[model samples]
Target: MASQPEQRSKVARRALLGTALCAGLVATLLTTGPARADHRDDAWTVSAPAAHEPTAHIRLDDTTGTVSLSVTRRGRTVIEPSPVGIVTEQADLSEGLRFLHRKDRLVDERYRAKSGKRLDRRVRMNETRLSFATPTGARLDLVVRASADGVAYRYVLPGGYGAVLGETSAFNLPPDASAWLGAYRVDNEGQFAQYTAATAPTGEYSDQALFETDGGYTLLAESDLTGDYSGARLAHDQGTGTYRIELADDRVQADGPLATPWRAMVTGDLATVTRSTFTDDLAPASKVPDGSWIKPGTVLWTWLAGGREAGQSLAAQKAYVDYAAERNWPYEAVDAGWYFKAGEWDTTDPDWQTNSWMPELVDYARAKGVGIIVWIHQRELDTPEERAQWLPTLERWGVKGVKIDFMDSEAQPMLRWYDAVLAETAAHHLMVDFHGSTLPKGIQRTWPHVMTLEGVAGEEKRTNTAAHLTTLPFTRNVIGSMDFTPGAFQRVGLRPNSDAAEVGLTVAYESGLQMFAGTPESYDRRPLARAYFDQVPAAWDDTRLLTGRPGREAVLARRGGDRWFLGGVYAGAARTAEVPLTVGPGRWLVETVEDGADGLVRNRRVLRGGDTFAVEVVANGGFAGIACRWRPGVTTCHR
Candidate 1:
């Protein structure tokens, strides 16, 4: 095996090789010297693939050498001109630079996503590279890609290396724009709130900063985040309606030519924003050796209900495993106390002297076709040696997956460690669920084995309400899979939502690895809820936003296999939500679960594609259901 430094050298070599491949594809406009250019020549524009898609215009201030951009959907402004630049250790590329040359290309490609809103996707973009030289002649390139859904740009240094100090990038919202944003937390667990851009608090915000603009909606996010660069957040300037780029770390080193993560903004109406695949489109292709072993499904988790005691108890785990097998759930997660104490990783804690029974439980679960996912704190596998020492051992024990928690950082080292862990986990054919982690940047596309991530304030947070729960679909979950472990039959969080609302979340919130948070007894008590869970899928082949808003209400219909599941959540006052059945025209058998005057109710009906499925709700209520296309002679609908 090669040393860490040697592996990094190989990565650098691969990056250089990629750079070489890019050079061949790029048609560079070369110049013998600094060309004196007019303001007209300073601007370049690109439109998305479709006629109605968003268009981006990039303009360079020839005098200050600073670049800025503006965007529009249809004819209305989506973004006011926003500044873009970067500051490095050796030179300041933000201003006082010279125009060198540029390149342009049209990119169109198709790929298969192992899981997400859509199983297959087409990435079409108009790519433009604007090159510049600092006062010291250091090269900087602003690469922009305009797609049908939105536009994204990133900084690249062709032969650049050294410390990246900061960036001058900013997203300028229109004066009347109202923003929905979450505060930045190491675990990325913050509730989203609404405020006018000027009134938005001046502080760090999670990467997925969404705005309801004058024209439509726009969601700010980043993609292709590698460990080579630190994670970034939006630093809002109160009263200015401008969000500046803030790196998670003070300094990040670029060992080779640095290609920063794509600063993406997905634009359009609520449906467009919710259904866009721009994040996955911008990520790299799959890197796993074979994705056949990777499975996405629901897992019965004991920690949330039974806590550490049940998680470590062999009897408790065996019981949970038995329930999982009975329910046909693919896995059961044992959190925290199953291993050593939080900080002590090398040796088992004296409290759990008989922890060796984990292997026995793994065998027991495997016999029933259930996999066991064990949790470990971040410190346990902080280094490659620790990961190497433990990963194979767990595989040998027949453990199918790992739930690594408390990462809480996206600095260069931690980011690199994330990449390394995903790679290593895939090599061992172990699925991974990252908890206490940063918002996913489409890593699932690069490593399909990355089943899920806990970047939102999920069921674990006591402060959660229907308002916070309802906002996630448009904000946090838009970018990638979220492990917001749904299905809590017991009342949870601060102002509790209706039980029907909890049932609705199983389908509304998308996660490749959805963990049922309720206890076996809780689920057993609610037969209807259990029935809904039994049919809902973690991954989808197609998804559509049937109707609703961000924090108030959200109704989504997702297709998995031959069934389309509908889930809707409402935060405030009660009203009737009418969702159009747009899945296609045919005799459809619909089974719905919703809040009744009593506890909960289930109803079955038949509807055609053009018909509407309306449900009456109480305040802070919700609904979940399944629709199957039925044949004329079919005797029964499976789900």
Candidate 2:
């Protein structure tokens, strides 16, 4: 057995030798291959002999330098430097060890510092290594390894500031070779019991990936804390067969944060290989489930003003219902105050339970074809006494869903209380919306009834600006569906106040059940925007990343059947962005973006097979619903 220092020294030499051997092996197998370019202009390219195989080559080029990586079957990649200027430094070897009872091998690795900062240490393993070479010719190497199920990755840089990100065994599972990735944060006191339960069934081979890319950082957990999975956020891609989890926070990080590193057992099954990445504002690409009871594109109403107070007069309540009916919006919500008095100190009156305005409002909304959701504080229902008092009453009201609010952040008891809330809600065949809460783990996958959460600083806060709205999609939204209360008809702020264009942005954003928060009268005033909202579907069958950089600008294209909706948003300043519409080869009837100048503009244009179109858009402003219909013959059209 080699000493740790000896092993560290052998890594670079061994890697080079291994690469030579692999290259030779490949040559022996094939005489003719794809033409290899010795040198070419910079671009990032990935190549794999076949999709089913585990090996691949990745090339990255930037103004600073170029990085080339060769990934092997065992989840290890070798990086080589290109002739570009980027400085790299090395640090002292720091070793960390983790033991996994399932896999017999001891995952051992030494850490290195690249930036002389412990937090920025680069983790590398025997099979997995990261290196950097500055165009100036400086290089740094980071090495890592795994002990059975545990991983030992090291970050190496120039300074003495280096620490190994290691994990100690706290929980165990039976051995299984399935890849599982989750976006989760480590809550010292367990809160995610259900999450733990979900991963436990997969056996001990499950490696939980925790990340803090949304600014606040935490460890990803394999099990639940107390009863709630506090650190986890909602995200689209929870690794396939392997559980993929996401962690989220509302506070924005200056630079994009690192998502929890993916951890999964190596398997031939592509579905079993869990993969994920962290982004400031990235939404999931998957569609919400479909069923008669739970359909996509349904609008939920929330009666935030005390139901009795807001709808005190039947005429007033009926007016709102009439507004919904006229607008074709589907549902209505009876928020918090409806359960008790709006401002009274002694609000909880046991006798006043059924006599509230909720029942009447529910009946009226039902007759108007609008569904009603009730609001309940989680604290009130934390115990058996609370649950006994509230659950039955809510079920009896025949409410569509309950918006649970004011959940405690770190308390284990509160976590457990939330889990019970979901179970109880599901048992009653009711849907749920978590408010004043954190990001979602993968609970929705197991309990598809849970719709959205208000972890974001949505429109409710009158101070929210366009920057906040623009930032949410890339940062907070990356986790999962956020009930951002998108449609705010009121204009509260200054220059970048919420407007029809902003409303259009929200519709373009993803959500399972969207809430249109504002007086229906406000929506009626903006008919064009209203028409666009009418077109916005709650769930999307497919999503494509059109163009734009993170935060600065983003343009997204989504589709439900043959219809395509395109939206673009800019954060700080007004700028022009080129959006590439290249989903498929088909002629599209394009609308000449109506910027509120002329009545809705429409243009008939035909696109040829295998062609790309570039559309120019302005800054701080965006284009939406420039509808595209597949036209087979029509060619050029006047702009």
Candidate 3:
């Protein structure tokens, strides 16, 4: 007889093969569902029952592969995906549904109270049918609704409770082919709290995504609520795959009165491929679309050189702006201490008076065709007094945005306070970038004006080495936008050195708004590297994932019309790999090779019509920004 271990291995292999077969069959069947339709001006659609029917309909644009899920009942469009595309959609009927895996079967169901009040029933995992009660005192059976676009698992609510809470999770695979999950929360207007847990097969908390809804028609919050669970929290365990979500909200909260609908997307797989593809699917389907809400480029600022009093460093500020303007970059930033050094929470610092030089920096940037964003510490802006006084003044000074830093932790009060800040900033037409903060949990979608947040120890931390840069996209970026100060051309210490290659890595790592955080002279020293910076936009209309492996290697492709940008990084030792180019049809001019101490090896080449290209690259060292143009009938070659 075979040994026990051998038998177990055989069994595991068989199970894996069986699961693969099942997955393939399911994918085939799903692909045959309804073909993607074109975008039409149809009435909005709501989650009304089949009896009442959908009074309105949401049209999907096949060209852009964008879906418009509208709420017809209220005559309002609740949520629209980003111009990119929809990743995935998962649905559930009721809250508190327990999922159980038995030896032979997988049981998932929920229950309700005898009085039809709340979900106060139990779900048992046994060799029986999955059952749950409706709010109208009726028992309903669950069914699977699969489609080509995605799978939709539906259920009926008991009673006259027309409210439904569904969790839809989407995913995108970037150039690196790393997976990122985008989870969405859908529920009627009500007080709802959704809890997401990413656990391993053993059910350990690898990550957590949460959203609390007050009351609104839409299911997903436009901006993430600032509180204990404001940012997307990651799991300490790096190997978590399985995720579970639980949502709870009374019908009263579901109603439109003092309640708002709940909606959210949660995932921690920040590989470039996942985010790019997911963003592509979620984008809105509209001709002449306006992406002003999505800030896609990098910011050139003089923070590190002058520190808190960067605004006082007028020469440095002017030089930075000149560098950005010369490169055709969009914006430059002036960090804190420009206003006044009112010890922590001192908003009344006399320096904030009309005589401050920060406002002059903003004006100077504007004159140079560059936008200026100032930084403000949270302690000063937390109170109503400070908000009313300073926010208006900052807006009056023509500040494009404010980087609110030092938001201590993930507490409920802090979350609420952050929410208020976002709201107030929006009121003043001032964009926000939360720094010294927590992770992002899809808040930028609603308040598109909220540019970026600093959750991870980004480029600002000079200690960030090339190795650390390789680990970020797969981890912190999975949740949402990271305000990582990208461009740094100075070589400081040994282990964690900053150079033009690192600046190139910033664009490659998939940051929406990149902050050029080095001396102005550094940028001047590297014009070719600066050329890449000039081309990098703060916002993107479409993103594509080419290839990647979490904490190891990642490659991404982003598109801004005719121009194409490709970036990749490797965290471990030197290695080689092939990455695919998925930016539609075109001849790509690739100017790339590993950068070493001596200089760049002239390996500028051209790539013709091909799906995937085999390229040799080093570990920790990577390639970025391959500018491609359509050269019909011409093959690309090394220069």
Candidate 4:
């Protein structure tokens, strides 16, 4: 019942394996088996053993010597033929190459996560590597991986040293595909917008661009971006429906055998795409000696309300600490200008205020069961010498965390600096939150002490639109922890979304260091909203996108311990969202806070799994709630 081509393929595989065994290559046989050489078209196929898993096809053009790739999932095309190669300062590795050999194996790795959407993660996939030699005899390898959720590939240059000019990596989508992407910026603060393949802006775009194609959904993103290469952006070619990888800087260096970051196409349905951990899976394992010290919880910040003055004033910081202690929040962040004047990073300056009351404030907060997070500019502590001098000092003062701000660069040097700083900070048992920084490339996995990063159009800008808020879950926030600094309840100023939606963002946004920016008095005015934030956690054990449409609405359920926190946000028009109760089987007491046409309203009810919980959400409105397993004595749930 086998076709002619299938018979030849079987013979080739058997012959290749027999030869490898005869050659006494037991290590290679166990890990990589043998490379099946196809004389027909010089193309190799790698797919997950499961029928539902994704499949990738790689081809090396004999005539042009260019490598191209295509992918399919569940018998549907996820990516068309797309060119993938890198350009170095020495040779044109993109074309005019000769095939040398190939190797492949299946990788199934499971690791425990300290703080993320999932507590435990498994990276199960089939990996194939194709080696080629350039005209100048430079060796390069194209490693492709196909998993249950997506396809990922990267270029590895052996014995590479010097400058890497650029990359020819691109994603070719269907002509009719639509995309939700954020514009590329150093700080990555642009709002996401929608566009058809042909109408997408030709400018640069940030990571994690979600596309809706005829076959299924595909999320374009990158991972494992280290100091060896520059941070990359997507440059669109509308006519060809292609988005090419463009390096952030021209001076990308490769000091050794260089391995480019994985360019991933996360493919499947919306839920599959949203739940995919392929990005984090591609990153290196945790480097922290012990992640138990890195606690995740709510933080009270003062910069949003009173700016630098409040963060510098001792009394204001103490008051904020008292409020955090009273609310049982874990941390209070005293932002920039804590011990130095604005634009004055040099501690040697005569007016550096060396005798400030930071030690007293830290002691005060520590006694009240609260920790202090101090802010410092990038210039003050960029080098190893500076970090070595300051990290131990902060630890001595009982500082629990540090907020490093104004990085504003993603060049190769800056990327390396991030890694070094995280290592040094971890040595001192202090967590890190990067502000005005580059987008997260799954670095939190490698450094568990990295709590969050400000790489989005967060609440501080005071220009957040409802559409932007709704789009983040499916776009920016999916890659890693995003520091949106949600829960700003101030009524004055040009606030666009509803009060309920603003309150709901504390749950909607995923951040290890979830900062509630509202002042104590402002939170006192809305006790119901404050009470919701009082109990909701910053990190989660499990996450599910109950229902979502980018730039329209996103309803999510995140579980912490036995309690599940639910959040939803809508844009454009008023509508009724049907939130399915899919937590599990059993009776659950659901307490919800939603938009009440006049303001925020709270309601409680008992529901079972597979029930449809209907909500009346107004234009640009949102909702937040809690759900707990019901027992005979369980009468009330946290609101």
Better of 1 and 3 by TM-score: 1
- Selected candidate, larger lDDT, 2 vs 3: 3
Instruction: Point out where model 4 deviates above 4 Å.
Output: 1-41, 342-346, 349-354, 491-493
Give a tens-digit lDDT track for model 2, residues 24-108: 4334323322233224433322222233233323343544233332223344321112121111112112111111111122223
* Deviation from native of the Cα of residue 198 in model 1, angstroms: 1.1
lDDT of each: 0.82, 0.43, 0.46, 0.80
What is the overall TM-score of model 2 with all chains considered together?
A: 0.57
Query: Which candidate order results from sorting by lDDT in descending order?
Result: 1, 4, 3, 2
| lDDT (Cα, 0-100) at 199 in candidate 3 | 27
| Per-residue accuracy of model 1 over 573-632 as CA lDDT, tens digit each | 888878788888877988889989877798777888878877988899999988888767
Model 4: lDDT to the true structure: 0.80
Per-residue lDDT over 1-639 for candidate 4, one digit per residue giving the tens place of the 0 to 100 score: 542223433444354345432233233222332254343557888887567767898888889988899887777778888988776655556777777777889888888776667768988888988887654455678999888888899988754334776777778888678888888888889878888766886777886788887668888888888887888888875565778777877657777778888998888888777777778888889998688899988899888766788977899888898999999999999987776656655466653435667889999999999999999888878877878778888998889999999988888888999878878899999999999998777788888888888889888776777888899888878888888877777745656777788778887788888888887888897787889989889889888888889888888889998999988888988888788988888999988898785667898889997688888888898889899998887776874
Q: What value does the lDDT take at residue 92 in candidate 1? A: 57
Tens digits of per-residue lDDT for model 3, 1-639: 642223433454354345433354345433432343222332222232222211223333434323333222223222222111100011122222222111123233332211100113222221212233212222222322111111112222222222322222221111121222222211110111122222212221212222111111111111233331222222222233222222221111122111111122321223322542222122222221243433445777667645765565677777778877887777888886665544543345565456576677778888988888887778778898889988898888888888888876554467668768867887787777778674454455445566677766565554554655654554445445667676555645532432434645655555555777766676666655666666666555455557765445667666555566667776556555677666666667766544545644434566664566655555456766565664665443212
Model 1 bad stretches (over 4 Å): 1-40, 341-355, 492-495, 632-637
In candidate 2, which residue ranges exceed 4 Å CA deviation? 1-292, 300-314, 345-347, 408-410, 462-468, 492-500, 592-594, 597-619, 626-628, 631-639
Best by lDDT: 1
